[model samples]
Target chain A: MTLKRLLSERRAAILEKWRDRVFACYPPETASFLKREADRFSNPVAHRLTEGLKGIYATLLGEAPAAEVTAQLDEVLRIWAVQDFTPSQALAFVFFLKPIIREELAGELKADAGLTAELLDLESRLDGVALLGFDVYMRRREKLSDLKVSEMKARISGLLRRVGVDPSTL
Target chain B: MSLPKPEELARVNYQPPARGWMEVKPDFRPGTYCNAASPKWLEWIDYPYPRQWSVAEEDWQLPENWKEIVLEGMEDRLARFRSLKLFFDICVRCGACADKCHFFLGTGDPKNMPVLRAELLRSVYKRYFTRIGKALGELVGARDLDEKVIKEWFFYLYQCTICRRCSLFCPYGIDMAEMTLLGREMLASIGINIDWAMASVAQCYDKGSHIGATPQAFKDMIDFLAEENERITGIKTPVSYNRKGAEILFVTPSGDYFADPGTFTLMGYLLLFTYLDLDWTFSTYAAEGGNFGWFVSHEMGKRLNAKIYHEAERLKVKWILGGECGHMWRVCNQYMPTWFGQVPSFLEVPVSPVTGTVFENARVHKMVHISEFTADLLRHNKLKLDPQRNAHIKLTFHDSCNTSRGMGIFEEPRYIIQHVLPEGHFFEMPPNTIREKTFCCGSSSGINANENMELRMQGGFPRANAVRYVHERYGVNHLGCICALDRATLPTLLQYWVPEVEVTGITELVGNALVFEGEIERTTDLRDRDLVGVGEQEGGEEEE
Candidate 1:
């Protein structure tokens, strides 16, 4: 089976385990909340994240086009951005898919004739996902910094306007 | 070694190699700590100290006999507040409060730990006040009150927002918040005061509000808010300024009169009062509800808070209706009774005119938090509210430290929000991070100044950290709090850490949902900005 077919076959189990590992970064109680509760608002962090990660999984597995997946990719990455995860910790989740795919299709890949090439292709694809995740993380960081500047400017913007510096200049 | 960068201090749980605090001196990095008071503000306040100095200096230029001044101040506080002596004397060195502080939890700095920060003062108290500490010295965990000790106290105490979250966790009921105040009072005695707080207190005393909003300036700002209300709701709500014979005196932090989000909350107050047709007046004399003096010292708190009752008497109002604020209510609830032995005859046992519900709890203080008043009105179904007006916004209420812990004002705000906004739009940050366990806005007390933005960001991390959870997971966009300080600083902090979320005072939401009887169809929101629906129509103003 191709890597795409393999991902589809074990999609539910793979996504669940990957999400469990992600939630495991929190303390046991917090991890439980991240896993057990499913309210969109009450358990918002966990609820949005599970969906975002699942969409990224499907997009990388070629279920959807790249253009269609940027928002989902951004949503998942935005979650990691605000989280306590460092750059490596955040980006590592993308690479996590590589291992999960490898283990899930281990028996089939070994039996198939051209499977070594397929495995290499899959590894390179995971590497691409990791790179994309890294870009998203950096963009999120830059957004936060930009927000700092604008908020400071906005703080005095009103007073400045009252003082008669052209509003456009601010 | 080198000083840690702000981000490194926040991310790393790694402690610098230290044998112990006694061997190590406090380090004051630029951008992470406050500069000392300017000579002008000190002279203005008649505080005896150097006119100009910097925390960056090796010599703070404290008054001569500074050590004597500090010791005498300590002794006086110890005698006056038994709570201070109890906080100073009793500590089993329990680690419960160590990790509870938002600063310590956010920054991972050991001295930011409430126990250790208090020990900076406790260590000194051990030397001079406790017989065992003086006799045993280093063995008893006591250290001398030297210049290094003073710098250490100044750095760490001011870093504390005095949220009192740590006090709740203390098994022995020791309060690091009170200890921080005690440390500040002692330091101020010797002229080692931060400029933001001292300057605000002085400004508040002299000009009727922090930032020197004089009576005319106060009137101008109110006029501006009134105009914004007129433009948004399309209803002419004429604001009364310092008018005598009004039934209620309205007091709020001057931030409302000047700042955006706070000003929006001010617009909420005007609309609510006008909607109910309540007789009220905003006094220029007691223009500010927030007490910078309370953050500074006990004496200053008393002096600053005396204005409310004095203004109430001057206006001859029935009772004071406090606007949305945090420490404003904290001082009013916890300290007002002690400040005034009994309610002045001018102020009545605050009966909410809109609901006819008497605030028995606040009768002794003659003050009512607007949330309490609003919640009671909602309970009685007094006002016509359109909760659907806020459907586009997702909301969360940050239980402000002072309001929730200091004054036990949690449910009233939640009650108010549930009345005006959809429950599905609201999300909890984390259970542990909400209600009594709520984290601070990271810049309350007097540390809301800008010089320590980096430090505030680090201290604010845990709250932001929790907020990020809800924001990413729930698509949550709005954060509401009762405190004006929270309203002012949380937006700035959120802009830095969780850029996706916006902060507002709860009343801003309340005003948005209020349906004024026979008013022109609402076209703009309280910020005087056009809203989603109204912008689709011919936008700017009604038929004159």
Candidate 2:
């Protein structure tokens, strides 16, 4: 079978496992809220997570272009980056897919020797996506720092400006 | 845009650390917190903390006996209130409330937890008051009440909005709000309170209102509203001030007298009273229902809260009808009678004469939430409404933290809105984020100061996040809440997070829907903007 056909056939089972592992990163209460509520508006935390994973899933299936995959990585990492995760822990979910993918496609690899070569390439591709996630995480941190500086100056800036003491000058 | 979008990352990541929370010192970064309290109000309130300290400065100037003052303040309060003493002992730190605080949830700072916000003070309470804490010291989670501890208290305590949502879930039923109130009281004892909170308390104490709007200023405001009402309804709404014979004394948050959207809410009160031909008078002496005193200290809260009862007695009004306000109702419903009770017998149970609905829940307090009163009138079909007037606006109700959690006023405001807005216009934010479980406006409790915009946005994230969801789904153009501060600050909060969504008070919707008899065609809404092609007419955009 073709690589796309293999990923497509087992898509539901693999995605479910990947989603559970990602949702498990959140506390039980938060995870339950995200899991129980499916509406995009009410359950935005879940929607962001799922949409982010969908981009990754589509990329793995060769359905999404590289740019689309990067945008999805940006969207997904934005939420995870700002959360209570360290640099390593934040993007660990991306790398987590390697083991899950290897396990889910184990039968395919054993059945066809050619599939083993495709799995090797797919593993490296996952690592590259992990690198992309790291870039997004660092960029998010810089944005936060810039926001903090701008916010600090702007806090007393209104009063300072009103009183003829230009905060910018200070 | 504004409320923490997971976009404003904190420079100091408390996600993984080697040290315990108490061991970590709080550094006041420029963007994360508000500037220190202004010296002028601190001096006027006779607060004992340093007069000219700055948060950005390296050293916070402290008095020689600041520790003694704080210790004495805590000792005095512990003796004065049983709840304070009980709270100091009751906490086992099981961490039930660890994730409950919005600040902690948004910022990932453990100290912002209700468990730890109280623990910051409780750790000291143990060192000084408890036997094991003094004996065991840091091993027992007890730390000396040092300058670093004081700075940490200033940082984390300000992050708490005292919304009491955490209190609802605590297994011990320990009120973190009560603990923080005492913590802030002790802080204020040393003049360590934020200037934004003290500013309103000083104004409310010296002037009749928290905003310092004098009687003449209030009259001028009422005159403008009356003229605006005349333009809309072609009937002049009579606003009586300090009228001795008036049967009802209507006092609202001073925000209503001065601020936008809140002013529209104030207009709703006036238009409804005029429509019913109700006899009510506004008292400049008790013009402010907002008790900033509640935010800082309990005694100061009483001094400010006493005005409603004192004015009701002096004016000989049968009862008082409070306007839509947030912490105001928390104090009125839960704290008023306890603070200034055995309220004079002259005040009767507030029964709406038009609807004949006796507001039993508010009987002893002798004050009714304006939404309760309006909803009662609306339910009984007493007021003539043209909800179609507001048909152009699509909105959602954001249950204010206090009223939903503190008072269970969930259905009243929603019932009123359902009647006032065009059908299907109102949408509920996620169940976890609304009614009793509502997220705060992020700017409540004195944290509303301009300096703490970063923290405020983070704190407001859950609310704004939920709002962004609804804004995406329902194309919700307005967020209607009952609290007046929600009116004043949410516009800024929404502007930052969901710029398309605007904030409005429940009564503002009521005012727009009010079809006054003998009224001229209103070409514009209360905002004085052209309304001909706006709102329910086509699907609504921003009202302006």
Candidate 3:
């Protein structure tokens, strides 16, 4: 099985389970934009769509659509942001979803050899993409949330302020 | 990768020598025996050892003299200060803390219940200290101050391990453990102190640690550790005593300097620091981080902590780091910030020169717990790990009640294990019982209190049960923890109740896996390895 074909199948599987949740909340215009973006891919758009759909879902379901979805998405992201989960959590979530997808796809793929082969290929490629996505996201989050560096600076500043010392003295 | 042959190991006949004390005769009959299975409601008269309050046993028979002495001793600044109004009025008795108590959960005994335990002190405090209580007294259903009530206060207050698991659940954030310490202090004022409490306080005063080993005994223990380190890693660890101007000061429980499991864990910290080329020193003065005074009274707690700051000042070290001892961490991590008026300003931001990650809010002047230090070091790649050293056993970490629930240090130790150990092996005991909801090792409040043994076992039962559950489900035989009291108390309790699972410090496994400059003879005896595995012979004996 080829990598491209395997990813195509996983994309299909992810879309099947999440499509309703995604489309239910997505505005018609945004849903159309997503479909257009997804259709532009010759291979499966499963991974990109799953990752991208969260933002679109938040925008549609939130109390104020114009307000930022970063806070809500941040909460959802934190559920898997711990050291035990961080870089692997997204991939793990993908892996967790795979069997369920495969079960749903079992009937369709059983009749087609080409689709079965493609599904296997899609799984491997999706694993790599999911891992890469998790790594990039975790690194960015780590920098933004470097509490020690931020806290130490704040503490030092607070101490200096109390003693009537200025940072400008340095 | 190969298991050691049984014949290759040296046999060690390790048994604790019995200390002289009164043993209750099992066959002797009092007029009637209370039903052992049923929960016994303790009466004011049934308080154990009322005679201990008297200056002499003969004097105990003279009620007038004994009462006068008790009242005279009790009416003091020490007693009044120890009996703080804040400790008395703060509790709301929501029972949110009921299940959080390890003793109450373990025993099904209502006396071990935090609400009732605090009431023992509260009830007395109300009767004497308040206007409403003095007026109403027996009419208001509050028991009047009497010798029997004082005895009950002495017995019950000491039952608390001071783990502060109850404090986490309190809506108003009342620390019941502090109240228990205050009660113990009040009791001690009247000369109604337990041997363990008195001995611990004396040891801290005279020998500079609660375990109270003399300098010679301390040297012997260090020598033993050096020999063991040589045997394991074949490196002669240069542990300098009283070295001035070192970059870091390592403060540990004196128990770790002497006891099994704790010694190995100490060796692990020493080797890790050496491997990282970090300059650190151990102070002879601040030898213990486990403040017995924290379990007794506020003033005594401050006195014990003052030694750490005093030693740090004399040595002039940049930072202090504590070893894997529970209450010690609770004292330094939680209490030291408030007690010590100001933290030192010039202390270097403790950057894990290994991992490049720094602990931000950690007590800069006084201390950092060893687990936090190791976690930071591992994060920065300071210590190289051979994960296979931990492979012989399936491992699950029991968050010491003080470390996780009390200090919010849940992530650091788990971070250390996840990175240090092999993949898929570091299973967590149920999340409900881990982290903030961790159960206490029953005997943590004070040790060798035979009267409270049943309550201790009962309190420790939930933790033992959780470990047993994980052991069965995950085939996790190794329960790695980071507290000294847990190291001393939990394994012993498990030996009687749940015999299959073993408890050890996280650093012991790290030591076993750590590679250093020289190679040492590896001994294969499981018992000699500082792994406190329970034996089957003593199973199911009711504690006490």
* Candidate that scores best on lDDT: 1
Candidate 2 regions with alpha-carbon error over 4 angstroms: A1-170, B1-15, B528-544
Candidate 3 residues B137-235, lDDT tens each?
Answer: 755434556665665565456557777877778787777776777666656444455555555766777778776667665555666566656666776
> RMSD (Cα, Å) of candidate 2?
7.0
Q: How well does each candidate superpose onto the true structure, as a TM-score? A: 0.80, 0.80, 0.63
CAPRI rating of model 3: incorrect
Interface RMSD per candidate (angstroms): 8.9, 8.7, 26.6
- DockQ ranking from best candidate downward: 2, 1, 3
Cα lDDT of model 2 by residue, B160-248, tens digit: 88887788778888888877788888877776767778888888787888777678877877777777678776878888999997888
Give the range of the ten consecutive residues with the poorest summed lDDT in model 2 chain B.
Answer: B5-14
Considering chain A alone, report the TM-score of candidate 2 relative to the true chain A. Answer: 0.87
Give me the runs in candidate 1 sitting further than 4 Å from their true place: A1-169, B1-15, B528-544
What would the per-residue lDDT of candidate 1 be over residues B1-544, giving only the tens digit for each residue?
A: 8885332332342213435767767657655787788778778767777467888878888777888889898888889889989987778886778767777655445677788888888888889998999899989898887888988888898989999988888999898888898889888888888888888988998898887878987887678668768867788878897899999999999877777678788888888888888899988889989999988888889888898998889889999899999899889888977887765777799998877788999868888999999999999989788877777678888999988888788899888888888668877777778888888888888986667766777677678867877888899898999888887789878876677898889888889999987777775667655655766565344542
Counting clashing residue pairs in each candidate, in order, gives: 4, 11, 16
